[model samples]
Target: MIHTTPHYHRIACLCTEAVETLYLLGAEELVAGISGFTVYPPEARQQKPKISGFSSGKLEKILAVEPDLVVGYSSLQSDILKEVAEAGVDILHFNHHSVDGVLRMVRVLGSLTGRRHAAELLCEQLEGQISAARLESAARDAAGLPRPLVYFEEWHDPIISGIGWVGELIALAGGRDAFAELAGHARAKQRIVADPQTVIDRQPDLMVGSWCGKRFRPETVLERDGWQDVPAVRNAERGHIIEIKSADILAPGPTLITRGLPQLQALIRQWHEDRAG
Candidate 1:
């Protein structure tokens, strides 16, 4: 029995990033199920039933809810999404890594979820923020402040560069990504910096590490062999270790700038001031 309502009810979000985006689009009331990892809004988890956990979930339970829409992300959830699709449930699969891709997703999701006006408004607001970031970067350049080389670490075990979205943030913040060439790679395995010497050779002026879902150990990084000689370490320009949600930065959702890019810009400005003085 298809409901005649324009908005979807009993929506199941497979990723927290999409969950956050739905909230931002003012469609929170339509969500009936959410991922267990959702933490940004704080109220979503408390209010919504935990229907899925990442890649594995009871498809029967999801079907029991009679959801009209299910949103999933990345290659990890491909199997689960396929199962949901086979069950006659509509699904939106998002795998974007770049900023523009996220904006496009916002517009698309907005239109699909009966929030077209909200989507347009959100895009305009985020693009405005992006424009401001560019203006700020230009202003700093006009002031003769040199842009520093930045290396953003996503994982410390094997060392990973910023993904597409994070790499975009690094550039918007007025610094050149030391590993910008690797930014658009789809997998973390591909983004790994296997050799310590490679990073040492880059001589980044700042190092910002966000060890996905874990606290980044800044002190541990400071003690690495030969790392002490790096300009960032020598000048004490090491940036703060932020605890960013992978979903927020990596997801093709509303948080690309609202929650991810602005914070990155603030960090870069701080690092620049530290190097100047």
Candidate 2:
């Protein structure tokens, strides 16, 4: 007789995306603990032991879970990863920042948990969605439709631009990223819009704000000094300024395609329709 099971039977997900991925792979039972910030499946919060936050976690509580492996994302969680690693537990930290990187994360995570086949299937679905969105954008372009210039704000006070994957999503959704040059920077500080006037000068046709878990205030953008002439601000009444929740877009997982992409597509489509009408 031959026996085959996942290499890591007891896993602790310190990021919401990993928890969401495990659940999507039907391996939720393997999850020993999850981050307090998880909210995607909703049931995950209700069922799993909340063990950590994005940048902080108690070593004692994490150790109490006795996880065979712990998974997290980015350098933001490096401190937590260090504590868990010193305690003789295994840790996988991902630092993906682009659409391709996101898909690769799904593939790698699927392989780690013995769900390679499921992950492949999920990837195929996501790829198909990406292709479909691209096709839609191409068709619009073929008809000589102008793509909207989009300004995606990850934060407000410092005026941070969206990340790489987000800029990719904007292009896929038939829009041009207002700050495409800044998107390549892995750190938020690097992507900061140094002067508010820079955004005014960009004259974006759409402004989308995620605000990293904070409530996005379109009025604030509209009220910014000398922003009255910005197309997005001027068209605020037509819904050009919008908010996509952080959980859907900020998390580099399936939700980016499943939830975030669709919203961008709709907003861009509406922008075209409004212009046509």
Candidate 3:
């Protein structure tokens, strides 16, 4: 796969994910179109023609681009891919649920874009950053720094806990996830917090909410019935309730490694230090 040459000249990205990663791999020249939701690097917006939204794309617009390679994420776009395929367009769909899966996606994109060398280098850099964070946690652990209990809310309504790589990110950031068991589930619904009181029961030391791009209002979290007793809510002086941008953490691409992981690491470190003081 590393040695194979890329046949695609005109490429279309069906989501923000592929668009960001592809640009990172230095494949910007190959892109003919990208999803409207892609905002990272800023230049992608100014350069590539927008062809898709979150789940679907403009078929006629895509056809106009005459892309030989079309890439996206999830089964949600299966129908779109089917129609695109029927129109003789090549499709590459990726669904990465874990950190390793995210790295694999990078390698796959590199191979697809004929930039294996660059991809390997990027992977090494990400691994090094994660290792540095883990090492810091290890040193702190040796010094009796306890891992903070973290609860990550992926959604606000009906409450969804962090999914897949999120739990892993929290751990790497030196926090124990309150709903670590649910991290294995790929779907958000599978990770749903059935009872709001479950969070109270878990007693997370830190509460981080992304709410998938919608503004994260701490008031909503604070307003939950009987939530006043929860340690995360009870603590006000130490930055108990935090918000991470959805674009930074939710996107399964280079941004997650570059932006998401660092934010998580900082918060976990801060949470620990706050209690230590």
RMSD of each: 3.2, 1.8, 2.1
* Candidate 2 Cα deviation (angstroms), residue 273: 0.3
| Local distance difference test values of all predictions, in order | 0.80, 0.92, 0.84
Model 1 segments beyond 4 Å from truth?
1-7, 237-248
- Candidate 1 per-residue lDDT over residues 1-277, each given as its tens digit: 2222346666888888777777888888888788887776789989888888876777987777678999888998999899999999999998888888878888876777788888788889999999999999999999999887877888988998888877778788898889998988988999999898898999987777777777677788888989987877776534433445565564556676877777778777887777677
Ranking by TM-score: 2, 3, 1
Q: Rank the candidates by lDDT, best first.
A: 2, 3, 1
Top lDDT model: 2
Lowest-sum lDDT 10-residue window in model 3? 1-10
- Encode model 3's per-residue lDDT on 40-100: one tens digit a residue: 9799999888988877676898888899988888877778888889998889988888889
Worst 10 residues of 1 by lDDT: 1-10
Model 2: per-residue Cα lDDT at residue 169: 97
Comparison by TM-score, 2 against 3, better one? 2
State which candidate, 1 or 3, has the greater lDDT: 3
Model 2 TM-score? 0.97
Model 2 Cα shift for residue 110 (angstroms): 1.2
